[model samples]
Target: DLNQHIDNEKCTKIRKQIRLKRTKIKKYKKQINDYSQRKHKYEVQKSILKDRNSYSKTDHDATFMRMKEDHMKNGQLKPGYNLQIATNSQFVLFYNVYQNPTDTRTMIPFLNTIQETYGHLPEYIVADAGYGSEANYMAIIDNFNRTPLITYGMFIKDKTKKYKSDIFNTQNW
Candidate 1:
């Protein structure tokens, strides 16, 4: 009877440990799989964000930008693409989508896309002040035989009375 009591109480401690380990493995099996899935998702996101400052989580190609349509008053930036579209007399001419927020950097690429897609550029490349820059102007002058009627960023300020009165102002000349 004493030998039977020993076998029941303390003779198989290793077997007890084995049973506990098996229970733990069964309980945490789903947790280990969840952790593995999360790690894979993180790796995918890192690859998608390579060589970019920021990319939208929902739309990997879109960048964070301030949209005019934000319903909130906080002026919060959201995922968006800069669309450069040209129109004349209410007719669409050319359009391009850019990840950059500023229009200045999109001008040359937009022009190139226009030429590539249409096989010809308009005589006058007209754009707003935002698309105006010395680099853009030089590209238009050197690469294409087109005229850039784009105004610079200071177009409004240059037209002011204070600007016109300045002797150093080139517009005064």
Candidate 2:
């Protein structure tokens, strides 16, 4: 009877140890799950903060622009400022740095910068098709009183005969 009593005590002790081990395992699993959830939440928050127009952390004023780097053949977008330069006779007449990546909106601002510095606008302005917006043309004519010798965006396409379906061909002439 004493041996049986001792056996029952040992069985109860083993069961208690098993229950304790299971409780510890459950606690550890809950902690791991909580950590995983917190990590995921932080990752989501980080992604949410990153927007299309997000600036560089190193240079806050510099915006993301596609640059022609030697290492990157695909032209990766990096943080940099757009430089606008006006030249005459192979000499740089005026230069400015703009935050905007596109040249279409930078023409007027660059011209205005030149005017502000020189106190007079040029008689004529010449630029590529990229600076051929109507607003820029109007600004050159009305605000600066200068002739804009800029081409339209589709100037090359319009010049090609293959693109012109309705225009009469001069091959017969």
Candidate 3:
């Protein structure tokens, strides 16, 4: 296994760092709750201003002040980097991390990195529905020079009704 051949001491250190990150996320949650309490009070003040369409007043002043304070305090939240991996039949050789929140933007960047490292494009690519989009599909054709067989999860909005089929959705396409 990979663990048996890796440096045990370095693995131990990485595990310790992960524990610290978990604690940091817990603290961020607590701070967000405190801000929510203050924002509730501001909502009461805002209600008074709505009754009178007249010019500015102390209630309006208080609302703006409270909103600004809450925005500043709640700015920090639990966040993490995204991990991207590229694997082949033989092995998983490439992985990268970024702050991107969705797989849509990641497809091209990941392919580019793999090409740079391996000196050739992969013949096939497979990913979940989250990574399936028009842009991502085009990237596979234009950038990777390969046709990706993408799989998307089929979901029906109305469970009671059968999905209507059209020419575009048929297997013939």
Candidate 4:
């Protein structure tokens, strides 16, 4: 929904430019393929020639590259950008978006960041399987004295039978 804040006209223009760039890159890809079966000298010359067609080639590549670079710079849309929302006793917003990816390796660092930002730790932490490594669990207990509410590996998905049998006993948590 970040695009919600962007100007409509600007977004349209950017999309149009991206589509045009993609078409150009596609054309270059075919040209490169045609050159591939030729001698190395021919391939090099074709690549050099392709580079000159800025709008048709380099511009297209640059557009995608810039989009990725901008996301990385902002730390809001990286592959590892994890969104963490915290709630207090009444379930009201406490603190959120201590930006990071769900990596057990980063758990302590991010927990530290949250503490620095909010001046304290939540009584417990909850995260999906991505953040369920031993390192993160230990850090939560040792550093924060908190039990991380992680999904137990024993749970199985079964929606059909209500008031279920022994297969769906205590392991369903």
Best by lDDT: 1
TM-score computed on alpha carbons, candidate 3: 0.45
Off-target runs (Cα >4 Å) in candidate 4 are 1-80, 88-103, 152-173
lDDT on C-alpha atoms for all candidate structures: 0.85, 0.80, 0.63, 0.57
Task: Give per-model TM-scores.
Answer: 0.65, 0.62, 0.45, 0.36
**lDDT of model 3 at residue 156?**
32
> Per-residue lDDT for 166 in model 1?
94
- Candidate 3 ranges beyond 4 A from true positions: 1-77, 153-161, 165-173
Residues 102-140, candidate 4: write the lDDT tens digits.
Answer: 345455776787788778876768766656777778878
Against the true structure, candidate 2 reaches a TM-score of 0.62
For model 1, residues 1-173, the per-residue Cα lDDT tens digits are 43344456653776576666667777799789999999999889889877666799899999888888878878898888999888989898777788988899888888888889889898998888999899999999999989999999998997789888999967688
**Cα RMSDs of all predictions?**
7.3, 9.2, 27.9, 21.0
Steric clash pairs (candidate 3) = none
Candidate 4 TM-score, true structure as reference: 0.36
Of 1 and 2, the candidate ahead on TM-score is 1
- lDDT of candidate 3 over 27-74, digit per residue (tens): 898889989988987686567556432223432322221122355686
Q: Which lDDT tens digits does candidate 2 get at residues 1-173?
A: 44444456657877676667667878999999999999998676566435335566677677788876738587788988889999888899889998888899789889888989999876879899989999999999998888999998988977776766645655423
